[model samples]
Target: MVLASALLATLGLVSPVSAGASKGVELGASDTEGVTTSATPLRGTRGVSSYEGTGVPSDVTAYGAQRVPAGHRIEGYSSPTGDDFGTQSIIGADGRVRVDPTTSFPARATVLITRTVSGVERLHCTGWMFGASLVLTAGHCVFNQSTGWYTGQLRFYPGANGTTYPYGSCTAATLRSNTGWTVDGSPDADYGGASLNCSIGNTTGWYGAYWTTASLNGTSTTIQGYPGDKSQQQWIHSDQVRASNSLRLYYDNDTVGGNSGSSVHTVRADGSSGCSGRCSLAFHAYGVGSGTHNSGPRITESRFNLVIGWR
Candidate 1:
């Protein structure tokens, strides 16, 4: 739920308990620091998923098993149209509950981001591991398109739940995103990744991404992130997909500001040998088109192939 229009100052250095955050601060990436990133558009067909996996992971250890069916769709959050999509209830507010440090595959893969804006401000966002050294997140979290500058120092805390940092923290060595996001601030192209200076993924492992042209309308989806409203602790929510186009997937999940770049995934039986039960589906980006309901850029062929190239 980043309010890029708010024109807030950028921030740096994340605290375990909302230590460096300001009151009345807007939730989203600040228009502060960011270095220009150079990336070529991954050459591939748009709107068509062209990954190598079975699309549905057979044996992912990310979650248990699939809970919903395909073609699952719902209305936007608090939509004036109707309540057919279901309502959002606070599962936890103080960031005390709804944490998943124990069943720690997806949660373990999730990471918290701290950025310094304009040399003085500090902002927070979320990301998840996609490679031994690559952490995926929202492009704006790394490059502030509004200011045409990249973030100044970027720090990542992996498997961070509450005050504990299970796998330690690392500074970003490199940040990457699509050329579109870097130039025009296209929300449809908001995905980004960070190459860390450490090997935290070797210990925690990373989730494998899957993409397909098949409908994800009814498949259950889960989103995980460290929201500013929840004291910047890791929060998890499980829900079903409401709609999907080539660019995005819509769902009703509890999300707030600071959740930009959170991973959108499907948990269930992947049926693959040694598979955990999860598949990477999308990357969360907050904005107007996203509205009140939780939505993200659906993992397309280009994004999938690019991420695989990182490995």
Candidate 2:
């Protein structure tokens, strides 16, 4: 009874999702070629081993993020929670729990993104490893409708602990997004990704994604990645799908700036048809201001195939 009693607390489920459409999209997604199963995580190899910010990368100097300075965090509101953590009003009393060993499964697969501006680098957005050299993130993370693609302004750290470079870091070989966001600036299409120069996914593994023409309203979703308030430390929260529109998903899983691009995923049992394990349902992109629920671009058949082709 003790373990059972502790279950809910351990899960730290998020508040109820707001009511909305529940219909799904057949994403025509991944397999031997579709979903790539996560692998056994490797220990921190970039710097010396320690529980916290002990591992060091050659290029990084700061170990933790500042209190998310204004103009530093996000580019703009409802753009992508990647850049700002202006106040707890956005995250809702911080319902997130920290993941101790950053080297665990999907935690190791999640990524910390840093973007440089005006000669300074800061915590930017969250990312999910979807291929050996590919990391999928928010559309705004790599492209700005006003200024244009961030090109060389971003750096990626997989399984990055507060100050550690457990998986080292990698830069983009190519930054990619669809015309929906790049040209149209659609929030429902606010998703993008990077093809890294290194094949880190071979060791860190990657997330599996799928889509279907069914309702996703009740499927439990967990959002875990680097949060701004906790410095560069990884944190997590969970909730069921609040609603799923043709191009986006809404949920109550608390998130803020620096949490953008985090995977909104569900754990499916092994041997499931198309996707199993840590199967991602959508990209976490916004907070409450985006219409009563945190939301992000939901993968569709074309979107899934497009991203997979990039991988």
Candidate 3:
């Protein structure tokens, strides 16, 4: 049985493993020195190059047909009073266990949740960069009294460490979670709940809602995230499943806290069914990490529609 919310409150976010900073790790390459040739970019076969690795496990594989119940929920990692919602886990290219990579889709829709604890500001959870001024993450990450949202200090980095891309960060102006998520930890009701009208202590202004959908299940995808408490830690994993709107992947790899809000992406390999070179099809915005059961959730397009419409 899962731990109760009260029991989980004592289990603050687990610290993730750390990897020294390097703009990004190179994937599927022969050596780190040469001009670096991009691989064929196969959906399920591409290897992650830049991020840290916890050593891949032998169980990683395509998902089976287990569906997450609509009633599944978890206690908020940061919020003592909030309920925890269920999410999907992913494996990074480094073979380390991480959260869903689909969250990185649409590129600019991912964000990093920075907060203040005991007057000391620190990076807390991962989030999605949505719209020109919106970022999405678990509501618990922002509203938890244990971790105060640093309205003025929060930042966002897109494709944070892609080997061929320059890194950038964005300042967050607002934060939002579903009213239900705030009440009973049932964001499942609003799994893709998003709002551009929410705010964080008036410092961050609301942009708009951007949630995910269940359409991504059974589709091939990739997951990226900073795990084990290391900033700049990233990984990529593929060959996934869309189980009840959640994207599930496998990796014996390990992940800890500070990985929340990682992005899950759809693989668009070169010469694949409909893909060409280096292009990702679509990505979900939240990195629900690998759990005790070896699964995670991916936000879907339908959820995004609901968030934008505040449905």
Evaluate all candidate structures by whole-model CA lDDT and list the values in order: 0.59, 0.70, 0.35
For residues 86-158, could you state the per-residue lDDT of candidate 3 as single tens digits? 3243333334533333223332233444454455545566554333234555555555444443455444543
RMSD of 3: 19.7
Can you list the residue pairs that collide in candidate 2? 25-212, 27-301, 30-34, 30-35, 31-34, 31-35, 73-83, 73-84, 74-83, 74-84
Residue-wise lDDT of candidate 1 within 1-311, one digit each (tens)? 12221223234343322321222121111111111121222232122111122122222222221122222221112324322221233323322235755236767777777775455424378888775678889888888866654544777766665555556567777788878789777877888888877666655556655666678888887888776555446777777788788888877766766778888877544343212345667888863323445577888654665655554
- Residue 43, candidate 1: Cα error in Å is 17
Clashes of each: 36, 10, 67
Most accurate candidate by lDDT: 2
- Better lDDT candidate (1, 3): 1
Candidates' TM-scores? 0.65, 0.73, 0.45
Write model 2 residue lDDT over 122-195, tens digit each, in one string.
Answer: 88999998866789998988898999999998988888776665677778889999899999999998999999
What is the alpha-carbon RMSD of candidate 1 to the true structure? 16.9
TM-score of 3: 0.45
Error of 2 at 175 (Å): 0.3
